[model samples]
Each structure stands twice: as structure tokens, then as C-alpha cells.
Target: MKNNNNKLLNQETLCIHAGKAKGDHKGALTTPLYQTSTFVFDSAEQGAARFAGEEEGYIYTRLGNPTTRELELKVAALEKMEDAAATATGMAAVSGAVLSFVEAGDHVIVSHAIYGCSFALFSHQFKKFGIDVTFVDMANKEALTAALKPNTKLLFAETPINPNLVVLDLQMIGDFCQQHNILSVVDNTFLSPILQTPVDFGIDIIIHSATKFLNGHGDVVAGIIVSSKENIAVIKSTILKDIGGTISPHDAWLILRGLKTLSIRMERHCKSAQTVAEYLHQHPMVKEVFYPGLPSHQGHKYLNNQMRGAGGVIGFELNGDVNTGRKFINSMNLFSLAVSLGDAESLIQHPASMTHSPYTQEERLAAGISDGLIRVSIGLEHTDDIIADLAQAFAHIENVTGKA
Candidate 1:
């Protein structure tokens, strides 16, 4: 409950105690949820001072709350950033961060392999505002260099990119952005801060869908942007405030509760995902396995250099056709057939039909998202049971395809 900023604490310790302070309510161990819409000031002068930014205190929930502030502080500490801003949802964070920096006619370079909603925001929503976005294969420096325009203001990428699992070189991208005087933003939702901290690699901004690994329980939908205090102040004053993408106090409290066990959950997630990826790689029904932990993965070397773990998600293709993919997912018992990832329970989904369906077939395939591809989010369940569930699913796929 004490501020341990003076002493360096391990990540697990930071997860539990980073933003925590001794509670006023009978010495509560956990931070209490201040669920009110507005806070009262002692006097009119105090209210005026708070409104004028001359004093520091919570005025309105839309602007800030104690619970949300605590969660923001926890994330900022975990990410090793100067500060952070929490948003209503993952897309809110992504859109708010982009809008905070760029204006009409500004160009941004984005990794082609990104979450479908994120791609839509840049390619469609931003385009409507006269902003130009060029999606390039960020792994290829030449491609990234060619995609950049003189007006390019931001470079956004997702390492261990969603569904596809392509690991971008964080240091390389950071250096490129520095040389070009561009803000480097990374969506570190996949690995979380426990496994990878992009700020350590010189990334200017770190974004996350706290609904994923940060929460680790799949109970809350939230987002956060971690960056220099200056950038966060700009975002807080303009985009986050004006756009009204503020997270609710209760949701923030839930995410804060989930953060306490993030390290332990992530360890299980990484270990189980590694075992599952290896199992699928050797399975006759699986044609390809896309997980950074696998030595055969294209980005395994970069992952080794940048991240501490391969993360929980695994992308792989079935040896058979699209129907085979459907059968495999349908046959799974323990692994739920759902879209979201990074939960305590395993999840399986077909990206071509689910998360990436917004893109045309050519676009999806170009980004290495195939119809037969299945994405599995390994959970805290025993590794053997997880593998057995996958094996049973694969067997069902074989039987259904007449390949048994």
C-alpha cells in the first residue's frame, strides 16, 4: 500500500502494488471503487481552482476518477512510461491516440497486419477526415521506408500482430520513427508489459486493449495509452476529453483487480500456448503453425530479441479446406469457439470469417490470414488438457474430411 517508486520492484510486485496507496477506509487492502459521477469541493474557490487547473483534484468522472487514475498509474508503471490515459474501449484508445496527433491531410504509416477494427479506423474513418494511411509490411524496412511520405507523422504497428502472429522488430521500427521524426506507437496487447515492454525499445507510445491480457479475465472492456507525460496531457485535454471515450469507474476497477494476477496468468498462457503450438506443428492435419515461440516461426528470432514470451495466441492452417477448419473448431469441447483472445479460458476462432471478415479475400490473404487458418488463445487450463482438446478437434476434422 506504500509507494515503492524509490525502490525497483519486480514486475509481479508492480502488478500488485504499483498504483496502490494506503486506503482511508479502515485500511482497506484493495483500492476502493469511487463510483460517483462528480467529486465535491470543500469551497467554491477550490472548485474554481480545480476547473482552472490550478489545483489537482477530481471534478467530474468524464475528466477523471480515482479508480481510473489508479489503473492508469498501474499501466504507466508497468509500461515504464511517464503517464497513461484510459479509454472506454480498445478502439477508443486507438482512435483517440491517432486523432490526438494527426489532423486533416496528415499521413500515417501503419503495419498492414493489424486488428481489423484498427485497420478500418485508419483506412476508413481517418480517410473520411482527409487523413491518409498507408499500410505496409512493417517487417520489411524497405517497404516501410517506401510507404512513408513527407507528411507522415506517425508509425503504428502491432508486434506479434493480431491473428497472424507476425512479430515486428520493435527497435528497428523505433529507430526508423526517430530518424523520420515520427511518433512510434505500438499496440502491445498481445504480450502485455510482463512479457514485452515496447517503451524499453524506444517506442514513443504504447496502446492496449485492457480487455485482453491486461485484464486476463475477459470480464471488462477497456483500453489505455501509455506515453510521455506531454503526449498524455495533449490526449487528455483534446481527443480523450472531447471525443468522450472515458472508461467507467466500475470497469476500471475490474481491470485493476485483474492486473494483480496478470503475471501468473501470462506465465500459464505462454507455457500452454507453447505446448499447443508445438503439438499443432507436429499434427498431420496442421499445415502451418504461427507462434513466435516456435523455432520455425519467421519472427521467432525477433521475438527472442524483444519479448520474454511468445504469448498465448497461436495461428495455424488446417491441411484440409475451409470446411475442415469449421469442423475442427466446432468439434472442440474445452476451447470455446469465440472471437476474443487473452482470457483465462482457451478460445478458438477462424479469422477469415470472424475478426478479419471486413477485409476482402485478397486483402486478408495478403496479410497472411487464410480461410483455413484458426487462431487459438491458450488459457490457464492444464497444458495437456488443452492439447487433448486440440487433438480431439483435429481428429474430428480428419474424420469429417475423410482423411482419418
Candidate 2:
């Protein structure tokens, strides 16, 4: 773990070995989980020194834990960041990254389309604290520039945006933020570090909902923020320490285990998603398919530059109404009707009713989220089986609508 050869290793190898604890745990191959709530100190002076920032050691679970620290280090390495801080949930990572920098009277510019809870946190929660938020289509350079104010401190957005699969130009956004002296934070949950690393485009911070792609098993609820060590220290000391959004060591351990297969998992996810998107695009019952992997998608152009892969999610509108969309979703046997994504099992959800419900109908529509839009997370299942499931669902919709 203490090698300078990390840069020489491939991502697949780094996933397994990077940030591994220094010494073998009694010759065990895996990193030992430090599950205790508290650690023993040599003396009262040492404990005091640790708390007073005069020494380096764990003072409490809220402040730090060895297991969580390993996860943070691993994620930081994967993201090509100086450091990272683990959190209890993805929203914690989002809130911590934003709140650590801005205060009352400050302004933030966010992508018009984003996850529901994040939209709520910025639009509703921040307003109560006297913080101003401007929701703009980050894909539009002029609109993003027009929304900026003198007090705007940061820009937050998601690439292959949630429920819509809209990819943003990271380099453009990063350059804009730097020119304006504002920070840039991106939600890498959809693509994870395996498919996209925002830091490579000069982004200031990268955030992930480890609950999604990073965990890959859908069992853990966790998050991480990667940035400069200085920014991480600020976040850990502020929103993470004061607001108490620390991740448990057990969740951190699960994520560490999940990281080992990330490269392979993403490969399957991308390949499967591409096939699924293509099928949906050609289906007679589908009105439009939105996936970066498809040449028809507006975001597809970024595939050659910013994103390494199109990811596992796809969004499409049916040729019929809301009821038809509902029938299609309920008709699927293999794809689970669930809100979360990046699981082994294929999952589907309605963004208008499920994930983007936090946005009012008007807001959702304005952001390009239609009432009939259906989103799916293509899983590790065989492509034939996955397509068969979708075909049956479409057949159900056809039967119900008497169309196609």
C-alpha cells in the first residue's frame, strides 16, 4: 500500500490494492474492519493532544474511523484527488460539499435537472437558510453564465443527468468556474469514478452516492467527497463534523469490498445499457430514447471527450400516455420497480412520480422531464433476457393501448 507505483498500475488493480492499510492484519489479505465506536489512547495527554490537533489519532467515531478512512483514501485515489471524506449518505456528500463553502446570502448555481432530494435540498432547504439558488441548464453555456451572481460561490451538476441521461461539458464548466472564482462540484453517482473522473477536467470536487454504483450491491447507504486535502479538511470540520453526517465503518467496509469489482461491473453495465438503449430506440412503442450511448441522444457527443462510458441508466418516453407507461413498468418481470440504480438486478422507475417528484410538474416539465418518461437501470442479466423483459413490457403496453 505504501508504494509510489500507484500511477503505474491500472484502475482495475488500483481498485483492489490502492489505499490498503499499511500492515497485514495478522497476514490477512483483506483490510480489517475497525468496528469499535471508540479507540483506546495511551494516556489522557495523548487524547487531549489528538482532540487539540497537536497529534494524529481517532478521537471519536464522528470525527474519524480507520475503516472509513481507508474507503475515503481509496475513493480519493480512484478520483485522482488529494483526499476524500466519507459520509452517511449521498445527500450528506452533496450538502457537505456545498455547505462547507457557502453561507447565508451566498448564491449557488445548480443543474435544472438533478436527483429529487438534491433538488429539494437546494431549492427548499437552502431557501430557509437565506441561501439563494439558481437552477439553470448547465448544458447551455449562455444560460449558465446568465444565472451567475456576484455572490455565486459554486456550481453543482450531474453528468448523464439523473432520469434524463443528459451529459454536461465538464471542461467548459470547470473553466467557467475558474474564470469566475467559483468552485465546481459534480455528482459522479451515475457514472462513478470507473466511467468518469471529474477532476481530470479541472473540477474542484467530485461527489458520489456510494449507495449506488460504488456499492453495486444496493445494500449500503453511503457517500464520499473527493477534493484537495485542504477542502476536505474544511468539509470534515464543518458540515460533516457539525452536522454529523459521518458514515459507519461497516458501510465503508462494504464499499471497499464493492470497489474491487468496479471495473468489471461497469464494463458489463455499459455494454448492457448500450444494447438496451438501442433496442428501445428501435421499438415502435417508444417515442424517444435518451441515452448517451445512442448517437440520437443530444449528450452522445460528449462520449468521445468527457465520459468513458454511457453508464447503466436509460430514459425513454412511451408512444402513449401516463397509464400506458405505468402498465409497461408494472409488466416487467425481471426489472424491479425501484428508485435506486447500479444494482445487479435491472431496475425501472418513473422520474415524474418517483425520483423527480420533489420538482413541481411545471418545474419538472421545464427541466425536460416528461410525465411519460421512463428510466431503467440495465443490470448484469444476459442481454437477451433483459431485452425479452422489455419486449414483453412493450407488448403489454401495446395490448393496453391498442396501438403498435
Candidate 3:
């Protein structure tokens, strides 16, 4: 049974204890792994009744499964939503959430600087279908408000946006969207629901690329869209099923396993990332640092008022040329040069060349992802050792560049 008591419970408790289904399985500690692809039905009539919504039970693996439902329920509970749907990947969640609410003639407003794939999907792909999109600087609320169209069906935002660590004022964005009677979709991937809940700020829909922080270890790839039950039904029945972006039973099990440690893992990730960010801020070799927690950051007030912690990613620019980005990346001893973030081991990468390589020089500059900018996804390593590794790397970088 969905608990109306959900409103009173603290979010930290939900992470560990929400979405538990009791059955006659001899008191298991965790959700049982129902690894079967297809479930057996009592009779053809029963199966038909289940499909017709007369009774609630598993029919086909593609449609729904017990394991997938558990994951959905748990994520929905954590996100403070009525229901949720898990998808094959992060982009699948974004695409489904967007297309579910919009039509060929509708319009959307999205943050100008977003995930690279999302950028292409909105400006290039969705436009082909005649869905006009307005990319706005979410930091500048005045600009965002001026860009809103009468036919805007949705307003999208990502806080502490991937690699960039740019924070968005959730309440400000949500309020503006509500005034215009438009749905607000927030990508809570960077902070996760552990640190901030978008629903609390009146956000209509919350999306997560569960592959990263939700899973914690970078082993599984999944996405979740959480919203009110009424909206969820429209999404689940329409684009969600027809588009067919469902996660496998094994991946669902993996996500369930990952949720158990989300709280403690985030604590370490936040602590270590702040340590690294502070170290870089004081370094002469670094020109600028983009982290929400830093007082010098543009979104400091919004971040302070809204979020509990800064988060694991830190973006800084090298003081030299484009080759400086390469020197900084190649000089690292502990950090691995990788693309994806929110893993247990410290991974760093040159976003200009690695993550946002699809964008041209002008495009990258417009997004605030500079040529010499390097993004590091701080992981759950010993803080002192992580700092030591980066300090040595900076020393090595100074040797190569004759600065700092």
C-alpha cells in the first residue's frame, strides 16, 4: 500500500527503508531477486483481467515485473513521488519525460548548458518533429521568464549540471513554470534526492540518470522518472510503454542493492569533493572554479538556501592553452581519465575533448565549458590521499607549464 504517511517521514530514512514489500519468504533482509523473465498466470482469464486493470499482477516482463516494480516503488518513495518508472538509460528517462507531455506543436524551455546528448536531442532532434525549444540561461531568471512562450508545455532544468556544477534555483524555476501553467521537469542527477528533493519545491516531475549516483559503483545503467500518480499514468501508458525503454530484471536488482548505501556514500563523495575544490581554488595554476558551495560561485545564494551539500563534481580551468587541459589530465597519478561521473574511484576528464566533444568551439564557450576546463568526479577515496594525489599532479603540471 502507498503510504500517505510518506509526507511525514524524513528523506534519509526513505533511502534505506522505503518500498519494502513483505511476503512469506522467511523474513529476508533485502528484496528477493525475482530473476524470471515471464511470470506464470493462473489462467487465460486471470491474465486478461490483469491486462484490463481488473487485478494487479505481473503479465509480461516487458510490461512489468515484480523486481522492477520494487525498484520503481523504492525510487518513487525516495524521490517523494506518487509513482515512478525505470528506463534503460539516463537519456531514455529524459526523452520519455519530455515526449510524454509534449506534442508536435508544443514548445519547451530548457537550460542552455545541459548534458551534451540532451542538447542535441532538444535543439536538433525534437525540433525536426516541430516541437520548438527555447534554451535559456537558467541562472538569469529574468532571461528565462522573458523566453517563455504561451504554448510552452514544459520547462526543464538540471542543477549542479553535469561536469559544470551549476546550480539552479528550483523554487524560482518551478514558480515561474506554475504561473504559466507549464510542467517543470528537473534533472536531480547531480545532487540526487538524497541532498535535495525537487517535489518539495513544487516541481511537477523529477528525473534521474540512476546509472551514476543512484547505483553508486557505476555497475548498472538505469533512469527513473518520478511524478504524481495521475501524470505518471499518462506517461507510463503513452510514451513509456510504446517507446519500450525498460530496464532488465538483473539491472533492477543491482539498483536495489545500490540504494542501500546511497546515504553514506554521498557523505564521503561530498566531503572529498569539497576538499579537492578548495585545493584547486587556492592554486595559482587554476584560473576559475565552478562549484555551488564556493562563496565565489555565481549561484552561491540559491545553492546555500536550497541544497544541504555541494556535491561530488568540481570544474576548473587550466591557465594555459587547450593543450593545458591535456597536460592536467595526463599528469594525474590517482585520478582516472574517464567520461562518466559518480563512481567510487576518483575519475577526471577533459570535458571539451571527452564529454562535450560533439560541440564546436563556439558551442562549448557558450555553454561555459571552456577550452582549458577540466571536470573531476570526486569519489569515495581517503580525503587526505585524494588531496595528496591532486597536489602532486598540480606540481607535475607546474613543471610542464612553467606556472603555479
Candidate 4:
């Protein structure tokens, strides 16, 4: 592969060739994995120079690895950021980014609706450390304004928020953070860089659960944080270096391989999801559908301006009660009842009971995640088969409940 730093490549090209090793590993086509725990030094003086930061080299796997570095560089280039850090898991990216900058006395602002674990980490875990967090609906400008404080150090949000499919205005948040001189972090896990790049909107940091669309396969669990070179250096030296939330070289390598096909996989996911969402929107059994691809969706307005695509996830409500919804989920033969999205296998899950269980019922309702709402992650399956599977589930549920 040719390495050209002077020429800016498109996202599709970047996915396959960005940050690739240049004529290294005995001229191997693929980036070689450096799976060793630590690197050997030539002499004591050289080792001391490396430890002192006078020389550039890897000391230990936790500090850095060649394979992992490639993954970080690739993701950073994709997100159009200065640097990136790969973590053991998505939560690691979340916690590390915030903890590295904020102290116990500082306050933080977060999106009212986010992934269940992310909600827990901000609302519960941060509270334990005396770090006050205000959960405001980022869509509400007044609410966001009211939540800000002099002690606020960072603002965290997710676009096309998990399970609900609500889209927050990235430009608004970015402008707010810039005016306030506070760091802004966005969890780009839902759309990946293929559909949306948060950095384009002036977001200070971008985070991802590499376990999802980035990997495209339901195998390795990993996460990455992309940000400015200065911010990433701070996070790597503090949260990652001392706390040890580094990713395994093997997992990083797998993610690198997965990135090679991300563009095509995401294209298929979006195409199938749009069809599925349209189907659900017209179905008698579905009382409501939440997908940006549908004009009825509030997020539809942001389609062209804020996002390149509507992404693969869809949220909907059944006409019947919660039991009917459960039966609908269980009756599906093709869509597995599982958590996590952006996989090759289609998945169906209930937010109130599954991913968002960490939140209290009142909190879930306040955040607009209803008990009857069903979240589906559209996969790379044939569109006809995917719709047929959902069609059968709807038929089964309506037949048993006698309501449609």
C-alpha cells in the first residue's frame, strides 16, 4: 500500500489504507500484530532514554503496541482527529475521557438520554466520587443552558441517542462548549464514522464502542477515543497509563481487519434499516416508528445536514401492551433477542428492560424511553429476508393478541 500524507483521502479509501504500516513486517500486505507484552531495549542508557521520553519506543504493552497503535491511528484518521487511544472496552473510553480532565470538585453535563451503561457511569459512578453531573435533554436549549455551571469541565452527549433514536444538534452543542471553554465529547458508536463524523461539527472528542459497527462482527470487545493530540496525550498518560485500560493487540488487530469492510457493511446496514423502518411505519401492528429515514421522524430534518445516513438502528412501539411487544420479540425467528447493535446478525431488544435497566422507571420515562418501545439493530442480511422475519413476528403477535 502507498503511504501519502500530503493527499487527503476519502472515507472509503481511509477505511482500508489510512495509518497502514509503510513497507514494514517483511513487506507483508496486512499490518503485522505485535502481540508481545513488552519490548526489549538495546542497552540500559537507551531504556532510560525511552523511559525519560527522550527517545520514541514502546516499553510495555499497556503503554503502547505497534498493532494497537495502527488501530488508533486508523480510527483517528477516519474521525478526522489528531490522535486516538484504543481501550479494552467502550466504558473505558467513556470514563477515561472524562476522568482524565475532571476533578472531584468539577461538574459535568451529560445528555439526558444515552446508552444504559453510559447513563449509569455518569449518574451513579460519578456521583460516588463527588463529581456532580446534570442530566439535561441536549435537544432542549434552555435545559442545556440552565444546567451549565462555572465548575462544569466537560459536556458529553450522543447523537441519534441509543434506543430512542433522538438526534441532538451537534453544532449547537459544539458552539455551546466552545463559548464556555469546556471540553465536548460525543459517543459516535451509533452511526460510526461511516455515517457521521462528530469532529466535523467541532466536537472536541469522539468516542466509540468498537464492539459494534466498527468491528461489524460479534467477536472482539473494544473501544476507542479520538481527540486532539494534546487531549489524547493527557488521557494516554493519565487514565490509560496509570489506570491500565489499554486494548489487547489481538483485539486491535481484529478491529483493524473489520475496518477494512466497514464502508460496505454500513452501506448495507443503512439500506436494510431504511426498508425495515418504512415497513414498520406502514404496519398496523406498529403504533409508531422512530427512524431518521422516515419523514415522520423528528430526526429526519437532520438527515442531510448533520448525518450522511440514518444509520441501522430503529425504535418503534407496538399497538398492544408490553406483553404483546415481548411476544413480538420472542416470535421473531431471524432477529435474535440480544443487546449491542451494528452486527452482521440482526438483533431485537427492549430498552426499558434490557440496556436501560440501570435507570429507574421514572428516569427512563423522563428520558423518553417508554416501556413498550422496541429497538432493533438492522444487520447485513438480505432486505427481503429481514422484512419477512419482522412481518412474521407481527403476524404472530397480532394473531395471539387479536389486536392489530
lDDT of each: 0.89, 0.92, 0.84, 0.92
Residue-level lDDT tens digits of model 3 in 302-376: 754688788888899878888867876887788888878888989998887777776778887887888788888
lDDT of 1 by residue, 1-404 (tens): 45557138788998988877544756687788999999999999999999999999889998999899889989998988888999999989998888999999889999888998998887778867899899899989999999989999998899989988999989899889999999989999999999999987889999999999998888888999999999999999999888899999999999998999999999988888888888889988778999999999987896656999999999999888888788788899999888888899999998888888777889888887888888989989888898888888877766677785
Which candidate, 2 or 3, has the higher TM-score? 2
The residue pairs that clash in candidate 4, if any, are none
lDDT of 1: 0.89
Give the runs in model 3 whose Cα sits over 4 Å from its true position.
1-8
Q: Each prediction's TM-score against the native? A: 0.98, 0.98, 0.96, 0.98
Candidate number with greatest lDDT: 4
Query: Under the 3 Å rule for N, CA and C atoms, how many clashes does model 2 have?
Result: 0
**Cα lDDT tens digits for candidate 4, 1-404:** 45356137888888888887664499688889898999999999999999999999989999999899889988998898889999999999999999999989999999989999999999988978999999999999999999999899999999999989999999999999999998999999999998899888899999999999999899989999999999999999999999999899999999999999999998899999999999999998888999999999889999988999999999999998899999999998989899999899999999999999999999999999999999999998899999999989888987898876
Question: What TM-score would you give candidate 3 relative to the actual structure?
Answer: 0.96
Candidate order, lDDT descending: 4, 2, 1, 3
lDDT of 2: 0.92
